[model samples]
Target: MKVACTEKSQILGSKVAKTLGLPLVYSQFKAFPDGELYLKTGALDGETLLVSSTADNQSLVQLLLMIDACDRSEITLVLPYMGYARQDKRFNDGEPISSRAVARALSAGVSRVITINIHEPSVLSHFRAPAIDITLAPEMARWVASLGCDEPIILAPDKGAVIFASEIAKHGGWEYDHLSKTRLSGEEVRIAPSSVDAKGRDIVITDDIISTGGTLATAAGMLKDGGARSVHAACVHGVFASGGFARLAAAGLASIAASDTIESAASSYTAAGMIAEAMRE
Candidate 1:
């Protein structure tokens, strides 16, 4: 089997292909004057590992096109970052479950699906094909270790992320805790470690996604104000929307990094190794 990718995931697709000791399928992409997408693949074998991060509408359409292009081949689809996954539920009466829509649409042509830290695992069941999700906690932990932090404590910005934080912290036997909010007064509020002392300790905030970085940025400043020596941020998907990275840096984050799942300036790590292993298994 050969490896192929949509336009947006070329860098990560290449890395996965190399790690798996497979050839990278040459693909050319362009946009027509009317704003339609175009793509041409060199060649595809009977089985293909197709890597694509649907980070936007165009990328999603492109992935469908690529799957059709590999019509004769069995495809193992990899979605490093699923764009519409956050809309997993329909809150209003007339609303559609967008995650289900996208999943069913994409599952039509692929034999199996793989996702990295997907926003909602339930969406996987929406796919007609067998689907699985993988974690980048080990990669994130390694990246945190490379930071040379002084006994840094891994922190989850909220309770929902405590499990992920613990996974990262266990790699280095670091203490882990979730941030807690307290109402100091009618107009005052405070955010700090739930049970651990942040004073004189380095901290790393970890999560699956960092969309606007608003919560993390605010937490970073608060942690610093609470006497934490340093605060950093890390995640599996760095969806730094609306100048999120800049916001985190400006909020006094000592450092910020994320996995290549979303391919941004802050992608200090890659999920290729994990992906390759999953494919082999």
Candidate 2:
């Protein structure tokens, strides 16, 4: 099978193709004056590996178009960063589950689906095809290991992400904890490492997605104020919506990085190796 990709995931798709020693199909993308998306991929007949990161509406539509373009090929879809996954639940009446909607749309004509650190694993149930999710904790562990920090602490922003943090910490036998909050008053709250003092310790706050920098940025300041030597941030998808990275930097975070799931200046690591390994098996 040959590898193909939407425009947004060209770099990552290329890496995965190279790792697996598969021929990468060339593609051309265009936009008309009326804002219609256009794409054409090299001839594909049998099996195909289609990689795409649907980070926004345009990318999502492009993915649908690319899938349709491979009508005769059996496609294995890879969504490295799936948008709208956090909206797995419908809170109000007359509201649709956005995650389910997107999943159903993409599942059409696909043989199987693979995702990386999807915000909610439960969302997989909405897909029409067999779906599997992968994590980048191993990659995160390796990246932090190269930082040469003294037994750095791996911290999840909240309890919800503790499992992911634990996975990363175990790789190096490092300490792991979740940020705990205490209410001093209606106007003031305190956040710090739970069950452990962060004093003079290097801390890495990690999560699956970093959409807005509000929480992490706020926690960074408090972690430093709590006497932590330094604070850093890492994640699987760095959506970094609206000055997220700048906010983290302004909060005094020593560094901020993410996987190439969504190519950006801060994508200091890669998910290609893991994707290739999974595909090989």
Candidate 3:
């Protein structure tokens, strides 16, 4: 088996390659002055694992090109962060199931697919090939445990994230609970149970993604108001879109940490080992 990676995921791909004891294949990528992309990879054969994170349209396009380049090789597509996964269903009439569309596009020329901490696990059903969804929750939990907080509490910003919080708490051996959120409008939200007694206790908010960071900011503020000693945030994918990290910091979070799924400044953990293990299985 051999390992290859797209430009954006090179760091993580190298880590995974090391873990798998596989030779890493390098690909050349270039953008024309007209804004078109070009990719070049050596002759691909045998079992080849292509690692990429579809974090944006450019990355997705590049990945598609790379997959097409691997002629006749058994391709194992590894998407550390699958974009458009949140839109797994058509919410209204005339709406596209974006996740399914993306999955269809990605399934082309691939034998199997693997993703880490994808937003909707159900999205795997959209793929024609066998798809595997892995989680970085345990790795994130280990990072939290290394923080060495004397009195720590794991908090989920919303009920949907309670499972993530529970995973962290379980691994870290701490108490955990989720906050209730009432969205009044796009910019306005109400977070509760407003009565968490976090006084003098370190709080860690765990979630799958931190896209806009509005929910996390609101939750952090509420925790601060509730007298938490300090607030930290962790997630599997840190999209940090539109100044999201700054917003979370401004909301009084002491620190923000995330896995290397998206390759952001907040990426303090690596899920390469986890993905490598899944590939072995």
List lDDT for all candidates, in order: 0.92, 0.95, 0.88
Tens-place lDDT per residue, model 1, 1-281, is: 99999988999999999999999999999999999999999778699999999998999999999999999999999999998999999999999999999999999879999999998899999999999999998999998899898999999989988999999999999999999999999998899999999999999999999989998888898889989999999999888989998999899898989888878778899999999999989
Count the clashes in each prediction: 0, 0, 0
lDDT of 3 by residue, 83-197 (tens): 9999988889999999999999999999999989888899999998999899898898888888888858888877787887887788867888887867889998667543466
TM-score to true structure, per model:
0.98, 0.99, 0.94
Candidate No. with top lDDT: 2
CA deviation > 4 Å runs, candidate 3: 181-196
Best-to-worst TM-score order: 2, 1, 3
Question: On residues 75-166, what C-alpha lDDT tens digit does candidate 2 reach at each position?
Answer: 99999999999899989999899999999999999999999999999999999999999989999999999889998999999999999999
Q: How far does residue 116 in candidate 3 sit from its true spot (Å)? A: 0.8
Candidate 3: residue pairs that collide = none
What is the lDDT for 199 in model 2? 98
The runs of at least 3 residues in candidate 2 whose Cα sits more than 4 Å from the true structure, single-residue gaps closed, are none
As a whole number from 0 to 100, the lDDT of residue 130 in candidate 2 is 98
In model 3, what lDDT does residue 127 have? 95
